[model samples]
Target: MLIFGAAVARDRAWDVAVELAERVGAPVWAAPASERAPFPEDHPLYVGGLPFATGPLAERLRGHDLAVIIGAPVFRYYPYVAGPYLPDGLRLLHITDDPAEAARAPVGDSLVSSAGVAMQMLVGALRRDRREPEALTPQEHRMAPHPPTDATAADAVMSARQLFATLRSACEADTVLVEESPSNLADLHAEWPITEPDSFYTFASGGLGWNLPASVGIALAESDSGRRRAVVAIIGDGSFQYSVQSIWTAAQHGLDILFVVPRNGEYAILKAFAELEDTPGVPGLDIPGIDFVALATAYGCHGVRASTPAEVAAEVAAARDRSGPTLLEVAINAAVPSLL
Candidate 1:
């Protein structure tokens, strides 16, 4: 099995990774909390992302006897979930550029080198006599289903899953997706397909306030390079407020970026953490009545509110023709996702 992490994409080693995987016909998993996706989500060998805790990860890797992890540590974990780091009879080979990361890992033998160079060398060294793994079974490329329109008034709002499905349908295949909506991330990952290298980004630290500015910089880089891939940042309302001022820079520079805000009117991520930590009754978690449209307009961006599925799709499609930055605040149903 092959496991990928951020540095693989950072080093632009995805082509070599694809070659290696195809040569070996290995099953691949995106490491948990990976900031950059190193492999195409549509690849047949691709399974999905791994869980971010020890017990859950071990259980996921139970059937695999050998794991080859590239461009990351043996594993990056959170919440101190207690369990064995690796299942019995499983061995890991870790390849990373950072020697410190290799040394710090509790499991796995390490190889320190540039990701691209190392993968190329591995591809050259593999014996020609090795048999390719059996072909992957065909699977349908279906996204999450849309919400039923005939629901009760209480269930009238668009769900996070529906919002992501709309985004997946509206966004271009080459669009660069920068994500920071923590609570709804699982839904986005489930719905959106990262089909190309360098097409997705996120904060590995899992902190707030970086995504907005970082997206502006990404748009700037695209301008400088003249590659001009569409930059789309999906941010939560609460986190958007942290560095909302960055939109001004995008506006001033005339960067063509689309900022999609899923407004649930609360710090939904914090609420999820509160539940996980068994700490309820958390005060100041609800942040309602923030006019994101006015705030975006004040920053000199084209602002619009999308409350329905059709409006969301139309706004996203309309954003492609915008000359400067556009902020589409989508009012979605409130739901705290499980952290694990």
Candidate 2:
């Protein structure tokens, strides 16, 4: 079994990891922040990204006899859990360039080296006596679409779950996604599984507002390369406000960025956390009465709003066809979504 990290794609050796997975009949994955599966998501052996929690992740890694983790720290966890990193009875191998990460892995044969080089060496060593590899089922596949039948466009709010599921089918396969919308992230993952390397990126830090600026950076890089790729950023309304100034730079350069702001009108994730911990309601949570279209205009970019699934599809399609930066403000429900 092989687990990849964001650094593998950064090194442009994600293909090496994919080849190793195919050779060993193991599924491929990256860290949550690195869900951009180095291999094609449609491949039979391509599993999705691992969860952030140690318990759920340990459960997933339990059955494998040997696990090969490369490029990433043995683990990058959020919300903090204290326990054995890996499940018992699972012998593991960790390969990474960061010596500090190698020294800190709780249980693994740590090898400090380049991930690409290590994988190349392993591939060369395994091909001496070729044999048919065993079969493994891919655990990552799309669920049936569940559109919101009861919702109405007149309400000026769409369901986030419905929005993500519909967005996947609407967007191009090769489109690159920059995600900052934490509310419906699990639904987003289920809807748009990463099929290619560097196709999907999210801020590794648990910070808000980075995705918007980061999207502008990626868009400029692609523009400079003379590529016509659809680079879209999905931001929570709260996060979108964090680095909204960056949009001015994107507009100044005429980068063709499609920024989608899921305006849920509240810090929905924090609201959920308050519920989980049985705390009192928090103040300064709701984000109300900010005209995103006006904000976009002020930044010298085109802007539109969508409250229905059909409108979302139309706006996204139109934005993709354009050659300059556009912001599509999606008025979504304020319902708190569960963390995956």
**Candidate 1 lDDT score at position 293:** 94
Per residue, candidate 1 scores C-alpha lDDT tens digits across 185-234 of: 76787678787888888888577888889999999999999999999999
lDDT of 2 at 163: 83
- lDDT of each candidate versus the true structure: 0.83, 0.74
Candidate 2 structure quality by residue, lDDT tens digits, 148-245: 22332336566776788768778888888988877657556666777677787787746787788999999988878887678988888888878999
Q: Candidate 1, which ten residues in sequence have the lowest lDDT sum?
A: 142-151
Candidate 1 error regions (>4 Å): 129-155
Minimal lDDT window, size 10, model 2 = 141-150
Q: Please, what's the RMSD in Å of model 2?
A: 3.7
**Candidate 2 residue spans exceeding 4 A from truth:** 127-156, 276-280
TM-score of each: 0.91, 0.87
The TM-score of candidate 2 is: 0.87
Please give the distance, in angstroms, between residue 55's alpha carbon in candidate 1 and its true position after superposition: 1.6
